[model samples]
Target: MTKKGIVLWALLPFFLGGFAQEAYFPPAGGTWEQRNPKESGLDPDALQEAVKFAGEHEYSGPRDLRLAILKGFEREPYHEILGPVKERGGPAGMILKKGYVVASWGDTRRVDMTFSVTKSFLSTVAGLARDKGLLQSTGDRVATYLWDGTFEGEHNGKITWAHLLQQNSDWSGTLWGGHDWADRPPAEGGIDDWKYRPLREPGTVMEYNDVRVNVLAYALTHLWRQPLPTVLKRELMDPIGASTTWRWFGYDHAWTVIDGYRMQSVTGGGHSGGGIFINTEDMARFGLLFLNQGTWDGRQLLSPEWIREATTPSTPNPNYGYMWWLNGGGEREWPGVPETVYYAAGFGGNFIVVAPEEEVVMVLRWLEPSQIGEFVRKVFAALP
Candidate 1:
């Protein structure tokens, strides 16, 4: 997002005083208990319109997603293990009010690749690292940790954990066989043009590059001394009672030797292939964790301060924060959604939207990008 296009939302506490939310943690193991629209504070018609609007807004992008990723994008799939992804879900969703399942549609149980929503999970892992002192500080240069070439050279040496998390690292070099420039190539650039381009100063420019995000993943894995998926499952997932079905994946090529053992470096998206494949129920649980400011079941899984830092507008990009998307009010991209809302957005229209003021945690998978804001509005219309 451009600097001028971003919006900063400062919330007023009074606006949230009316909707007194009650805690309702779902059972960790089985199908979540459901509540009717009235019980959950939703207008029946408004909730209906939300799903109908999402179903109307199908993937309007180019037809062949795989071909689009490979050729025009020149990015390879993380692995060929999966034969084919079923047709993307037709606007699957689950609405949680006060942590109770208010309404749901489609198959919430289907496991689908959540693309960049994985980044938010990755960021949460980073927060965990800080909590455990794995990372002394976000401002510390990553070169100080790994002496490898990944953080060597002029601009890269200055790249900090914050830079990597916020997409301001602008870190040079290639990893997992994907170059930095390969993400969003210039209108006029040949292969040579992209490969040899000058590096943007670290923590200066915010460019959305999967390779850079992957770099963050690799570095975090090294620091955690284990696979990110393992860290996530043990630290945050299990504690919050997330299911065993969700999985985090990395490209087959993205492997590194850490602590005398080789481990896969997970990426943040399904742009290539692997990321986080999770069910909507699990995604909603994750969202609810954030909605309650990282507290789940009276336990502080993620520190409240970390959530603030993760959601705060980065100097480089107001629309992003620690791999999470900020919903400060803007003219586009969730225009009608409340300013206090922050969400984990991914490719193919997977979104985990959290509206704290409304006590609403919503998950929408495989909906149209243009209709996300409208869907959120429909949800809000249902509430007071």
Candidate 2:
């Protein structure tokens, strides 16, 4: 045989492997591989013990009430719980009420890319800054926190914190499609040079776009004078006693993998539209913090009033809040859900649901991008 043919044969495994690998997309699936919580230098048994305590006790308050809530769900599945949404296009769903895991289907252990849900998490951090007086108000102009000329035009100048939060920024710029971020000219000269196309007058209508959230992250990091991850860790994650093993996947739009875990953080981008890596349990704890009105262990991470305001609908669209998705009303409504239930939904079915009335927090992480609405319905149906 020819030498060239022999060389090609030798390289066949790598070539075939590359072709067989799945493309990086939202909600891709497989299976849950158990990870040693201790290897990440965290005690899995402690977490389990906490879960057990939560299941056994009727939490009163003051000490680890969040853990109590999670344990409650683990004791039993909701009376009417429906699914893992295991259809060919269904979501890999998990149910947690008061912090305990009740049911999980599909690849429950596999970390999946959750797009846009990252926006809600970013909003929480932004809210934290505002709570600390680092950021004045959601009404503050983007120019107040960021450089005056960072964004161009009257619309950009008129862009307020509220506008960005509600998806009413009117800036029609997008970083997707064939548009390459590497190609855009630097922010220089007048704001006009940036030339943002307006969708409507700022604060007029809702249109979900990526750049608005990315810009919000940029503005937030600037005001806090810290990197986005640091701010989030100090203000939100650490306060909630979340797992430290969880790390955000930077720049690669993918899932956040826990230490010693083999999953990737869902996509690497600074934008809040998507780019947070957290485990299902930590996600539940985060939701529980909100459900408890931002207080944990007698300390207020965020003001209760701020929680109400942030989670409540701030626009004509009743389903959206300050980056969170309100669940009571939307194009897809769920049955048996109280009017008070709200959720932070990410693309590909990453859900951190807070139902205040029921004291329920459900976190669903899946590898199927298109089954979000279906999963939402299943969760509601599963409620006892």
Candidate 3:
């Protein structure tokens, strides 16, 4: 080969790599910079229409979350508020393309309860633990690390980290005043029947039980040797330049003594109350982290492998991955959207959608729950 041909071949990789890294990443704090919609191949008029549709389809529930929680889960026996809850603001959202804000609406800075979106954060905490070698593999039984009676029984003993993350643990017990069977009880069964029903083997089914979710949080707290919130702030939020306004909380009575230090074990959702209370920008930051395959700027905050495992569909639930919801052409998928898209969703219509192929991170708060698919479809329609 000619000398020129060899030189061109060596420079080819560098040129391609430059294009891969050209997307902008916002600074840690202050105002997030904006980019023209045209640059991202998005139609400005269609993007505005998407924002308008979000505003017009506000969540129908009362702004007073206390009442909303009570009414939403009234069918569950012994359901009652046990933690902090605040009135929520109206519709707020932000859309980012290549880490630059292209469109936003409402009060993006308003902090409010994120409900089950907290699960995805909790899942991240677990990922950090594994990355640091706190606990071994996700397939390892929980009883190996947490020998303190939480996983003592036959059904519980078989539970693994992956099972808990996938919401297929079917862990039968009570934690922080929440009974596993009492959470989202079957429509026709009484308490006696529901409580004593057959237990499915761990990892064989997906059940959205807050009690079991809190159990995972409890185990993770023991593994980390500190409160989950503190670990998150030091390791994630602060590094990502998140505001200090966000807070994570647990039930009022959920405290435990660890290594002579008394600390609270946070909950994974705001079922009774208390979870993540964060604004849209922070949520977008998190989504952007995932969209970039766990890298921020150039530093690796989370391993790409961890992010991939967290988004990959689990066996029992095609629409769920380590707590993040996947759009894997399942029943929950948004029609016409790419299956590569995944999101962190919560009650009351809060969602942080990360579309890797589109280089988009969207935060939506308080849109009608049933309209999410249609809302997402509209957002994708704006893309060329």
lDDT of each: 0.80, 0.55, 0.92
The TM-score obtained by model 1 is 0.89
- Using lDDT, rank the candidates from best to worst: 3, 1, 2
**Which candidate do you rate higher for TM-score, 2 or 3?**
3
Model 2 ranges off by over 4 Å: 1-94, 104-112, 172-198, 249-274, 367-384
How does model 3 fare in lDDT? 0.92
Instruction: Give the per-residue lDDT of model 3 (tens digit) for 148-211.
Output: 8999988899999999999999999888778999999988979999989999989998999899
Model 2, 256-355: lDDT tens digits are 2233443322222222223665566566667777876776655678887777878777566777888877765676456545668787776444677787
- TM-score of candidate 3 versus the correct structure, residues matched by position: 0.96
Residue-level lDDT for 286 in candidate 2 = 75
Runs off by more than 4 Å, candidate 1? 1-21, 61-68, 71-87, 329-333
List TM-scores for all candidates, in order: 0.89, 0.62, 0.96
Ranking by TM-score: 3, 1, 2
For candidate 1, lDDT tens digit of each residue in 1-384? 554434322233334423334667787896688888887667888888887877778656543556534543443223232222323545588998888888888889888778789899999999999988889989999999887788998888999999999999888877766767767777686778877888788777788888899899989888888999999998888988888899888886777888799888888887777889899989999999988877787788898889999998888677888998888743334666767889999877889999887888989987877678778888888897
Clashing pairs in 1: none
| Regions of model 3 farther than 4 Å from truth | 1-20
